[model samples]
Every structure is written in C-alpha cells, then in structure tokens.
Target: MPVTSIVKDPEALSLTVHAEFPVKVARLWDAYLDARQLEKFWGPAEYPATFTRHDAAAGGRSNYHMTSPEGEEFHGYWEWNEVVEHKFFEVTDGFAHPDGTPNTDLPVNRMVFSFDPTPEGTKLTITAAFDSAEDMEQVVAMGMIDGTRSAMSQIEQVLIDLRNYSQTFATEAELVSDTQVRVVRLVRGTRQQVWDAHHDAALVKRWQYGPDGWSMTKCDLASGIGESYLLWWAPEDGGQGFGFSGKILERVEGHYESSTEQLEGGEEILGSGVPGSVNQQTFTGTTGGTLVTTLITYRDKAARDAMLATGMADGMEASYARLESIL
Candidate 1:
C-alpha cells in the first residue's frame, strides 16, 4: 500500500506516503464524512483515539484526543484550511486542551490529503510538512505515521464491511436489540437553563424525541421533595398504539432517577416481563466545571446480558458520548 512506500525528503524535513486500497473513492469518502463511521476507524497508531466537535466543512474545527501510556490524555485541534469534498482537504493542526485552549509550545502542522480515483481502486496521498527537522523527527519517533496508516486502513475496511452487511440484511430494520438509545445530554449553561431543558415540557420536545401524534399532555416541576415532571404520550392510534409514559419519582437538588418498572407495567413475571429501569442523573462541581453523571440501571440481569451481548458495559458509556456534544 501507499503507506508502506513512504520516503522522507532528502533535502527538506518532510514525509510523503501513498496508500492504494482496492476500494472506490466514493466508499472511502462516505466513511470520511460520517462522524460515526470516522469514530470507528480514526485514531493514532497505537492507542485509541477520539474526535470531538468535528465539523468537516470549510472554516470548521475539531479536536483529536488520545491517551498516553500513563493514561494522560493529549488532544489537538485542526481548523480546516480547505475542504474539497471527496477530492482533497487541508487543515492547520495544533495541540490544545479539551476545552479548546491552545498550547503554544507544540509544533503546528499543515496537512493535505488528496483522494484520487484509479482503475484498480482509490489512491490516497498524504503530505504533512513540519516547520523543522526536529519537529519531523519528534513526530516520527512518536509513531504518528503508524497511527495514520492504521486509521486509514480501518476506514477502508469499514466501507467493505458496510457493503457486505447491507446485502446480508435487506428485508428488515437493523435489529440493535438491547441497545442504548440517547435519552438526554445536558451541559449546564446555568441552573435555570439546566432545569428547563430537563423539566420544561415544551423545551424537552425540541431536543428530545417527539413521536407521531404523541404529545406532553401534562407536566409539573416543583422545587421541594415532591418536585417532579411527567410526560404522557398520546399514540396516534388513539391509545391503542404504542406509547411511553414516565415520571420523576424522586428528585434530589442535583439529580433524579426514572423508574422503569412503574412505567413499563408492573415488574416482569419471570421471563415474561422485566421491570422498567431507573435513570439517576447527578451533577457535581469540578475544577473544570460541573460534571454530570446520568446513571441508568435496568435491573442487574437485563443490563448484564445486554452488555455481554454487545461488547458494552452499560448505557452510561454510550450516553457519555452523546453528553460530550451537549456539554
């Protein structure tokens, strides 16, 4: 592949690599655009990598975060210099704190990626130039090239697998049984704003789901121990269809939990039914700011089985991902 055929510049401090995969440009382009798809493949050479605030558009910005050997997180952002759809794109990259504060000491890089279509497949050429030889040496020693190669290879594989999966499952909706769906991710801009997003019926509908014909008929949010909110879903088929109903049974100043069994119907009878779950949301003061934890418990057995089947511990980890965006 192109990554294996890389050669450093003899006169200048630079490296150029070409990777040729037996995949079409269109397939690779889709993988690059979908944030979810990118999440599956994008990362550095050795350790796992993550991206945030990713807007792959002109004049947009994003941050890449990766963990070190000691579990220290290092992150950087790239403000797009240029974006040319599936053809090529350029960006100016630099180190930064998770909160977008730039670090001045780390060297900045301008990288250009060109995607060219070939008869055999797609050819991707990457050119990243550093300000000095030391900069190049430092990054190479850090194994940046290996990380990039692995990420690109992963992108190609995702495309190939997606095509195969689509063909294999054509008749029905993809069954993500025992999956975690996003409930709400709140980043507190203010105490009142946080409360409104979670408690206000009108505002909740804007960000949360609104099913067909179902609407919030009544909601009450009080401040003391009895403070609570309830949403009554009115099914389109006039109560004969599927609907959802939930209430805040208990509310602490900074947290609340939703009871699953009460909403789904009395506790499940053995294998016949499972109790509704509970969602407990807590807000704590942190050095960075307020950190919120929305812990959801779906009875021990149900939660454990779901985790074991899907390689996920609980919905908390997945919820945290959606929370990162809301915050």
Candidate 2:
C-alpha cells in the first residue's frame, strides 16, 4: 500500500495525502512522470486511465481519459506549473469534456506534490487546494477520498515489480496458481507488428526457434477461431523433431487469442506424458513497447511444474531475443 493517510480540511479548503514507499526518491519521482506507470494507478481500479498525451516539463500538459466498467469515459487534464526534479511539482488538475475543453461546471484545483527522502524510503505528500468550500465538498461527495485511496493502492506493485514491466528485461514466467502460469515479455514493436509476426508463416519460422541449431520446419497458423494450427521444430544435424498441434479456441484480432496446446513428438521433450495446457494470450500497448502476456493453465500442479522444470523460461527468452532483432 503506497498511501498511508488521507486528510480533508473544510476550513483550510485543502485535501492532503501522505504516502510512503520503500524506494529511492529518484525512482519514485520517475514513476510519476512515466505514463506507463502512471496509467496503472492514476484512476480507480474499475475505471483505468489511458494517457494519450503526457508531457512532463513545466508549462506542458497531460491529456487522459478514464473509462468506467460500463464503457463511459471521463476526460481529464493537468497543466504543469512547476517541476523540481526529485523534490516537488505543481499542477492544475481539472475536469474536461471528451473534446479536451474544460468543464466549467466543475472546479479545478491547485495541486502541489512534495517528495522527501527518509531513512527507510521516500515519503510523498500531496496537497490539493480548492477555491471554495462548496467546490471542496462537492468533490468529497463524489467519492474522491475513496477513489484516491484505491488508485494509490496499486502503486506498490508497479514500484516493486520492475522486471515485469521493464522493456529491456528478458522474458519471464510467473506462477499464477498451482495449475497455472503466466509468461510475459515486453517486446519492442507495435501491437499490430507483434501480431503479424506471430501469424505470418515466414516471420514465425524466422524467430520462433528456441535457440541456435533448431529451426522451425512447419508453421501452419490459424487466423480464425475453431481452426487448427501446427508448429514443429527440428535440429540442423538431423536430430529428432517435436511440435504442438492445437485448435484456436478464441481469437480477438490483434488483441487476444487462446488455444489448447500439447506436445506431440520428440523423445527429448520433458513431461511428455502430462496432459497439455490451454494458453490465453493478451497484447497490450505501452509507452515503451507491447506487453505480451500468456496465461497457461495445465491439467494439474504436476503438469505445470514439469513444463517449467524443462528450462522453458530460458528457451522462451532466447526466442524473444531473436524476435527483438527482427522487429
């Protein structure tokens, strides 16, 4: 939890938030300026924000909108007034229409965020000053206190999980459950480019090979749900080959896909007797690159452990490294 306390003062016409984090002051400051990290916690969990434009310099502006679970969007912007690196910044936070025009019916607040270093970590203090008592009360009535707390609660994960979101990091796998795991990679390419690389036969053959000496011999892909696909790889020195055959269970264009996958051949393959897995993949665009998340659900814990013990993560990293060069 990044936020420790929230104070609302009626007579002072101000709302202040105090949050502590066990990170260097510079790292904490960078997370706010980076749009990728900001979007993760800038809005409430139900209404995640997307920042189409974020300018960090003084006198610059940031344009963002949050969409509710019901698909309604609320636009907002910030006019940066002053910035002192690793210390504090001032901004005018306001509500806006979908067209980027200010909504005069609502109030804009002057906000100053101070960052201080302590023996343990960094402490962030945010003071938002309102023009009138009525305006301050209005925002509080709109669940501002609860919403702010909910937004800041997510910051701890972003600050701690550096490898998961960093573009330069190699592909990694995270355990989701006893019978499930998630493989993630931040690849340098547009979502469409990454999608095409997976679907195009020639491109797939070029990089999907796990490591040197192995080559993709078959790359039959399915572009629609219910269709079947086949992937096979073999060694250059006439070594035994292995492959996976599955049907596309779900397809959402360049955004998401899922299928049932199983190992078919190759005596060298580990956990060959275990039942296969269902893999669902999602592609999300970020400021640095595209985040590819593949969730694999196996038949049981034994099967999941077996697959991971086969050096699967390292193999995937090698392939992703190849993908980086081509893209």
Q: Pick the candidate with the highest TM-score.
A: 2
Clashing pairs in 1: 2-18, 2-19, 44-147, 45-147, 260-276, 260-277, 261-276, 268-273
Q: Backbone clashes in each candidate structure, one number apiece? A: 8, 0
Q: How many backbone clashes does candidate 2 have?
A: 0
- Model 2 Cα shift for residue 195 (angstroms): 0.9
Over the stretch 1-327, how does candidate 1's per-residue lDDT look in tens digits? 335567678466777878887777766665554334555776754455555445455565665677667777788887777877579888887889766677877778788878899998888887888899888887788777777777766766677677532122111111122432212222434433454466555665444433335544444444444344444444455553222344455554433333332342212212223334555444322112333334345555665354334322333334233333454
TM-scores for every candidate against the unseen true structure = 0.52, 0.57
**Residue-wise C-alpha lDDT for candidate 2, range 49-110, written one tens digit per residue:** 87654555576667789989998999999987988868898999999998778889998999
Ten-residue region with minimum lDDT total, candidate 2: 161-170
Give residue 203's error in model 2 in angstroms: 0.1
